[model samples]
Target: MLRSLHLRAISPEAKKVGLAAFLSATAFAAVLGITAPAQAPVERSVAAPAAASPDSVELQLLGVNDLHGRLESPKAVRRETGGAPVDIGGVAALDAHLDRAERSHPGRTIRVHAGDMVGASPLLSSRFHDEPTVRAMNLMDFDVGTLGNHEFDEGGRELTRLLRGGQRSDGGQFKRDAAGRKANTSAPDFEGVDFPYIAANTVDREGRLGLPPTRVIERAGVKVGFIGVTTTATPNHVLDEYTERFEWLDISDTVNRQASELRRRGVEAIVVLAHSGAYDVNGDPGAAAGEIIDEAREMTGAVDVVIAGHTHSRLNTRVANSDGLGDKLVVEANSYGAAFDRVRLTLDLRSGDVTAKSADTPTTWNDEVAPDPAVAALVARYRAALGGMGERTVGRLAEGLERAGSLSEVAARAQRRLANADVAFVEGGNSRGSLAEGMVTYDELFEASSYEHQVMRMEMTGAGVRRVLEQQWEAEPDAPLHVAGPDEAALDDDATYVVAANALLMDQDQFTAFREYGRGVRPVGTDLEALEGWISSRGRETGVGG
Candidate 1:
């Protein structure tokens, strides 16, 4: 679709400006066209960027976020043309696209990530505890990356190992053994990092040093400063154990400090890679907190660009600083490698300021571009390496659930099968991706229940169930919490109920105090034996059990 549109829009001569630019502009326009109809009643038109000043360093920033270790192409997210059945993900393909841009304009490209690079990882990265993902980023030479909330999934200690990169967390060293070397001798140590991962908002309450705040990359004789920030609401998605040792600071303050330091260091152009999100100007159903844009505008000093992620919402707008400092360009590439983000920041070398720029988010259609051979090779290597691991099935799929059905339906069915509740309460995260046709494997099952949610069952009356559901719907958009419900329906409290949930969800803020089942407690399985027995009494069914 993108290629055809490109062919129709410009001639081959225009390709010299770089495919990233052409594809980005075209994809942005196409997405706007597609979403406009859905957003009717409220019409939105893309505003043209202001005129570029004569002097400025032309910086092309390409970014991706929430990759979640999707090294190969993802399965079709939706059946429609909204997502592709063909593979559009893979580091090789991404590398290929990057190469194309570089070939047109070599050494002028700055590739970045907005975080969530590791956890909920696919087989390739997960088998090695996200080491492969980190290694791939190193190979791709990421200039600097911000920390996403998922980075803490394995706890801060594991993340520190990856960041330092001295040795692989999988127990392998970067060095090789010599035939005559002593078995007890250690391998030569690897230099800590070839790149930097920054988390300005992340602080070590114990150690007192936070993740690197910013990096200065000299490209085309211009030094670009980048500030990084993790989400402030990270605890909502991560385990308490990992975050217990650290303190999360205000994002705006982090930005202010980093930007000031960068300017003090004589870096001219600045970009903020915030693991935050954008929202509609108004707080409607579609509008989320545009944290990246807001923070950039609010931060004092010379900041030119903001690349955002985490909410997975696509954005294309230039919000002027709320304090009347200046305009900050904010661009977000949609999640899952579904799109490519390109920000063209032109800087004036003489004045060390941005004079003119344009940034865009372009769809990455598998059908439109061939996968980069190198990236493909890397993905293929991982696929083959983990082939047996990925193929191993953990459970049978007898339930015939279609992705088209409501998310509630799938969650309810899972709850019914797992807990034998007359009415099951399902949380929103219960469903993130769709199950494809044919047998559902362990991979599919894990994807459905990826968060470390344990099997939690609590007995409750039908009326109690309805009340719990009411609490689920009342979750405020800003103060988003987990699903709410009593963990153990107390017989003494006048209701006997059985609820099954993951440990991760059980400890969530939303459900923690639901009807007074305090933190980290679950109903004893022995107590729910009767309910399990009743479920067993009925013949076992398969497939989502619906």
Candidate 2:
């Protein structure tokens, strides 16, 4: 479906000339000569940009977000193209899509990443510490990106190693022999990103800025300042062990501080590359609501556009800012390299402010172009490295598990069996993939639970176990807290029980209740390892998958 959003009111305003220009996604749909109804609608038009003059020049921003280290393609159907099933993801296809988009407007396009470039990934990338993903990003040439919650999954030190080249902490191409000499091995290739990843809201333990807040880029004599930030709710979602060493600043305050400084340095057009994300409410793109929406609306007038991610949803529309200067365009592509954004902005060469702007969201349809051969080869090499991985059937699922809750339940059960504990809990951390019905392989299990978190065995009384179960409901009404144990009715308050859970929960604030009763906490194998053991055992006994 080729379509564009056309608005009826709000032209150029004088205040916008020296001030700010806010707008949304309405112009790109028209590029294909298609009119669509799902786009965000304003009270007429959502644009607040200045009228175009001869001094105005066009600038483009190509954006992507929440890739999650998908080095290979995922089987997804493109909604815009009549729901035809095809391979739409993978670094190879994304490289192709980005290449084609950039060529259309040579020298005026900036490839942007909204965050989550790694973590919560498939076996091919996660096993190699996401080296393939970073290498692929460098190949595509991203201009600027921000930090997402998942990026901190392995802790701040490892993330630093990813951004700034350093020694591979774990398995890699070389190993130290008896003489401490480099030994050759078939390990992953590791390196840092070639682009700048900003983190305006991320702070160190001392409340000091951790990463560069903003970066200014000049195209066609027009300079646009980009501010990068993740949602402040990051600490809540990440491992407590990792988050304890860091602090999260407020999103709006962080952006304003950086935006103000950028303006003082003579930057007029400020674009925020935020890790925050939002969705079109009720299937209406214009009616977006989420943490990203709240941040967008609260942004000062100095900001122009917001490239957002994290919720892994679509948002192509204009929003009114708190400064009341005008509406600003907010765009987000879906996750796993599935889609991207092409935002066209009319920059006034005189004031350096965006005069007019419009954007469109396009799916990374590999069928549209020949996949980038280099990236495809890179993905192929990694797949071959894990020879016979697909054939190693761990267990069989009678039916596929599609939701995170189902997979979480599997994790919980595996941990219980591994620890021979009375129960196990699955909470916190991100669940990346789902299990398909049929014979489950080690490859599939890695995809199902990718987080590298150690499992902890805990001793708790039945009363405390009951309390934790109640706490799950207390936190969120009807929130599914994965637990593997005896029947609820059989759980006696006075009896003692052993619990298995991710090591992360012991430090997380939300699960602090566990600390109140947790005793004799000891480290068990990792969550993935437990699952592997459980599946292998089941696969051997049943001969019919789990």
Candidate 3:
């Protein structure tokens, strides 16, 4: 059953009217068994009974962030007792972990995502436009989610379609059933998302949110309100044309305003699901905190909990609210379903307020736990749809290609040649994985460059090249840009040269010098296809498998 909550503006003032109207139409939808009012009133009854007890009730919140459509577990990095890397994460294993957590918490548990549940997905899910991920979430019973920058990768229309459910623009269909069996006919229509996606800061040209701003969940006589928001820097990450109609408001102001409205409606226990996070350093989650901390500080004492993402860091610690609201719970689970934030809130039964809270981020290892059969079936269905593309031999490697060595140089050279430019630059991070020895498949190639980045050829002066290289030090310190063709020996300060790079690097604000100094910007092929052709050609030349 579809369930949702709509929170209208608390005041009718001119300034707040727009936010109120927007929120009233866009609030959390109950994907679980919980029910919420379609529209909440400004004032709510808060009278306590004479028999109100001093005892507290505990609520468990299990959350994941930056899932990024990892329907199956990726290669493991941590070793098991048997000296093998532990195979951890994937919807099935995650479902098992959730089951264990739910069984421990019983009726007091709720599941949530902090954003980036989709986008930059592997071919298994992205090939089908991330419908499988949504389906998996539905089976897992996610209560609520927020938008991430990646969710807007394909623009508002596609995102809207994913949330609303229907046939794809291309009228594609699932090729297999949930049990992994090939279907005799086309699969059913996409059912969209079962849960509501909330984003308080993202508003349309009409000042309306794309989804609900807040969602209230009541269970066992306790009510908790959640306000969801994406980072203000969303536009900087996504394509401009996709987000042209939307504006991001100040996160702190939006949360504070929404908290006020929720409080007036008798919601004293509040949580903020922000798609922004701080890095954990020296065992402190707030160490070198980012925008989420700023928003939490500005929230004063109105907000009690903050679940964050985007940085993909695993942290669980408390940050004191500026308004003397005690310590606010701030937590973030690592990305790609690797870990989850398990938070427990102790609520005062009499005051209807959260008295204390604590949280932990645990790895979702599949070593000991059996995969959830249903989720496994779902993943298999999508995996089957990948057909032979995943296994088709692309080339063979005599040895693994390291992200920072000759392999990267080779890739850059290939990109440069594909764009017919003097040099090409590829970020170290963009090389998601390395090419293993022996046969290399299309899947491995994709794993190396996971993003749907297109190649762009542009002209830049030698000075601009040096500036872009220098900018790398801003983050990676000694990290060098893998350049092909023009070595340091061939450097010319004022000479103009043609270069190629992934669209993200070319368009990023950090590399604005590329555009400011660049001329004759033209699109080449996608990074994947170019790399494929390059690898194929290399295989023929080297007499390797192709």
In candidate 3, the residue pairs with backbone N, CA or C atoms under 3 Å apart (3 or more residues apart, or in different chains) clash, namely 3-30, 26-212, 27-212
lDDT of 1 by residue, 59-91 (tens): 678888888877766654443766546555566
Among all windows of 10 consecutive residues in model 1, the one with the lowest summed lDDT is 34-43
Model 3 TM-score, all chains together: 0.81
> Candidate 2, residues 450-494: lDDT per residue as tens digits?
876788888999988888887777664334478888877888989
For candidate 3, give the lDDT: 0.74
The list of candidate 3 runs beyond 4 A from truth reads 1-54, 77-82, 170-188, 206-209, 283-288, 402-410, 460-480, 488-496, 539-546
- Candidate 3 on 407-496: residue-level lDDT in tens? 666678778879988888976656655777677787777767667678889898898887787776665234456777667567797998
Residue 431, candidate 2: C-alpha displacement in angstroms: 3.0
Off by over 4 Å in 1: 1-56, 75-86, 166-193, 208-210, 279-289, 323-325, 367-370, 392-425, 457-470, 478-492, 518-543
On the 0 to 100 scale, the lDDT of residue 149 in model 2 is 90
Q: Per-model C-alpha lDDT, please?
A: 0.59, 0.74, 0.74
Top model number, TM-score: 2
